[model samples]
Target: MRKILLALLVSTIGFSQNKPFAKGADVGWLPQMEATGYKFYDTDGKEKDCLQLLKDRGMNSIRLRVWVNPNNDKASGHCSKEETIIMALRAQKMGFRIMIDFHYSDSWADPAKQFKPKAWSNHSFPELLNDVYNHTFDVINALKVAGVTPEWVQIGNEIPGGMLWPDGSTNHWDQLGQLLNKGYDAVKAVDKNIKVIVHVDEGNNNAKFRTFFDNATRQKVRYDVIGLSYYPFWIKKDYTEVIADLEFNLNDMVKRYGKEVMIVEIGGEDDKVENTYQLLATAIKAVKNVPNNKGLGVFYWEPQGARSWSHYNLSAWQADGKPSPALDAFKE
Candidate 1:
């Protein structure tokens, strides 16, 4: 009883800040973006005004993707670590909590392709491991220097199988286990309080999730959050199918794995964009139990499309030349 009383006292003093999210509650939503669209640069570029735009829309957080080396690309612009730190600082000034996504690659690293950056391309296995550790430490420290502390940090991007491929690939859990530890330790080494997440793409595929998280746990690497990406188009036959699978997995992950579940990235494409709003609404509704009880909130993968609003991607909010059903889904 004394221990319980002391614990309550400690929490009362430490958690004096506002937390819309209940300790195990789910009523909170983390409205955010990949934030690559803001084009956070100072080369006399047209101000994108993304921070102000999000503020007006009631978003509480921003997720920024950090690349080892950035080059102009169709999918991701490859925002450099420095550029990302500056952008995160700007968002912090705007009062938005940050979720720093480390791609650990020079370009986009998803479930399909987890490419090793050119720098780590020729390094030996041991050398590559150290490289990842150093890179992780450096990025976190850089964020501290910029006065932008991240609330959540993803060690890798949508790591469906494994990252750094072949060597750090999911196909090989033994080596993958070591790599996971290296990244997790590096983050904890700097600040034990910061949340570390290992993200995977197959949120609906309970089997895949079980296999992935099960393997990671067996490997002995502890993580605070289980980040899952559930895009209707990418994961299943359609949005409905994905949502059904999501509901199943949400309960399964939390129950079976005993770790908090976070839907880090989720959205539909043009083919499914016709009823995208309704589809997303239904999905969000299906997971309403998360905010008040479980930690389940979905983020619209990348709301801002490429350079100039392009029609190819129904993923962007401006694809329709204005807010479309896809963009409207978030407001619900």
Candidate 2:
């Protein structure tokens, strides 16, 4: 019995030492895509569940985005709080680890625009702080009630300049820091084990990360992970050109901040399957190479969102309702 117990302990330790690197997709558009009759088929041309298709392609995690109150438009809206909960529950049921991305807006929120949700537009700075805390807590608490606890929660999405418009922008680091702390606190209030992430775009731009995180450090922001977005298609540069920079930034972020790093959002052009495949393979290798195992994961943004439905060129899904070969990189 003692030898058996010792062997079991050794196996458990080995499992922990080889924690599976997160290979995931942000399928926020999935619910809407299905509602609008967007079907997903595997390479064999059989209709299949989108999440299962992703899993078959070596994905083990799903990321969902939450908007405060969004319209029901098929393309650009309808990630409302309720929809998010439903989606998270579905993904959780499939054994996929979850990551919740809070956009904190009525519609889209990114580096270019982090508009205050229309409902909170008139709020004072203090009220805005309350809004952030209450909204984050409410959604996260609801997820908890529904028996789906996320493994990670992002306070904001791709917030390079910052979020919540003029108030939470980098121009007002103090206020931004306070707002971020509120979000961090809210997530902890619900589940202290849930890792909180602060996300920004341009993962390859070391200077951007340095400047943003330097300010975050000075302002004493609270977070457990650094999330980034890397899309060579948008920058109109080949992945070959930016991949080295991304690797450098990934390592530098861990060494500089002493925090885990994740490529929270990354996508290549759908039409360029071979190139995208190589890009993904190289990117995954770079992330796994981060020393001390601080590279937590990589998530492709909207990979299942076929261009025919979402009209997004960077998806990993082909127009024929099948996954592009590019996704096979995750298998490695």
Candidate 3:
């Protein structure tokens, strides 16, 4: 009886860890869009909850980005800790698994720019490390207090070059690795089961991932998953031209690093519904094809962030407030 109980416990734990393929959307702009009185609708022209609409389209998870401290701008700002917790709780209440993306900056943090949050601007390298740990722990802990724990927490957003700039940039890979590990430690401190992801943009470019992750491995940066952003619209290549490259890169990363992978961000032109539909399908297929189910999932970046409000052409939302057919790919 004792041995049988032990085996049952092990199987239960493994089952909990092996979640279903995460069909998701990064709706970081959602609360702000709703605050600005944006309305979402279904194909039948009935008003609908955006979250519910996304669920209706078969999204099982939701991604929210958190900024350190942001202005209340609709398009450009406001993913503060308070807002993120509220959104996470709401999504969780709706049965959506949550993934929290930490931008670490007051505003945007990505390949082009990763400026430090205003409060951390003058901190020394050591102080910056503590800042990363504290800030990450604080937000995640608050979510825990609010009865919403994320399934995944990304240390930094799209940091191919690196994040927190200067000291934590690729120019200082050693420091960046330390910073990433600090964030990783903090998340585990809050909840060990929460997988930590290190994100970078340009998922199709194998060289970029190799160089960055090679540095990460050399520095012993601790993380559970590799996160990628694949935007064919931004790359100015059709998904067809670069998708095989993405598949190859996905397999390579899994083989090289012995880590799971996820396409954490992807989108196509909202107007090109059919093309975007195909893009979504192919992107999902590429990730699903990763051997041994190492490809965790694919997430459309801001599908509910309509182009009319965001001025971003890549949302899977139509001008009429209904989701485009592109999002229907998730249903499969």
Candidate 4:
């Protein structure tokens, strides 16, 4: 019995060491797409569930973003806490590891804009901190109750400038750090094993990452993963040049911070399937090449979006409802 127990323990440790590489897609718009009568089809033209199709193409994880009180915007109601739970449960049932991205805003929260939610606009700094903590805790707790424990959780989405607007902007690192720490504490209080991420856009810009993380470090902001968004067309550089810069930056970040990293959001022109494929392949390879296997994986943002969502020109699906060849990059 002693020998058997020793063998079991060793096997368990070995299994834990071999963590699944997160080949994933941010299908946050999936619920909305389905509601709009969008149906995904396999290459064979047979109707299939979107998640299954992605799984068939080697995707092992799903990323969903949650908005706080999204009802303020008529077009942004699908990402509320309740809707996110429904979507997360579905992904879990399909055997996909989940990552929850908290926008902490009623609408989009990116470098260009980090507007405070309408309800929290007038909140005092301390009150706003509490709001952030409580909202994160509540959503995570609800997900736990639904039997969908996320493997990763982002405190805010693409928050290179900072979250919650002027109060938490880069200029006010103290407040930003406090808000981030509160969210981090809430996540750990719920599940210490879940890896927390601090995401930023501009994967190819090493200077930007260094600047953001330098301040974060100075302020002692706690986090586990460094998430980045890489878009080739947006960068507007030669493809090779972009890939080289991104790889260099990825390596630099891993070595500098001693933390795992992932391309949390990536997209390219939907019409340029071949170029997009090459871009993804290069980026994934760079990430996987990080020393000590500290690289987590790459996640395509809204790959399923197509003509239905005219705004997302970077979608990886063709007009015929078939996934574009660009998705083949995930197979690599």
Top candidate by lDDT: 3
Off by over 4 Å in 1: 1-18, 21-48, 72-75, 270-274, 306-312, 319-321, 325-328
Residue-level lDDT of model 2, residues 1-332, one tens digit each, is 99999999998998787667899999999998898888999999999999999999899999999999888788779888899899999999998999999999988899889999999998999999999999999999999999999999999988988899899999999999999999999999999999999998999999999999999999999999999999988888999999999999999999999999999999999998999999899989999999978998999999998888878999999878999999999985
Residue 176 of model 3: what lDDT? Answer: 94
lDDT of 1 by residue, 49-150 (tens): 544544444456677787887675544554777777777777778777778788889987998899999989988889878988899889988888778777
Give the higher-TM-score candidate: 1 or 2.
2
Better of 2 and 4 by TM-score: 2
**Clash pairs (backbone) in predicted model 4:** none
Model 3 lDDT per residue over 261-285, tens place = 9999999999899999999999999
lDDT for each of the candidates?
A: 0.68, 0.93, 0.94, 0.90
Better of 3 and 4 by lDDT: 3
What is the C-alpha local distance difference test score of candidate 1? Answer: 0.68
What's the candidate order when arranged by decreasing lDDT? 3, 2, 4, 1
TM-scores for every predicted model: 0.82, 0.96, 0.96, 0.95
RMSD, one per candidate, in order: 6.0, 2.3, 2.1, 2.5
CA shift of 302, model 1, Å? 1.5
In the range 1-332, model 4's lDDT, one tens digit per residue, is: 99999999998998798687799999888888888788889999999999998988899999999988886332366699999999999999989999999999988889999989899999999999999999999999999999989999999999889999899999899999999999999999999999999999989999999999999999999999999999877867656778888999999998898889999999888888888899888888999998878899999998998856646788899988999988998984
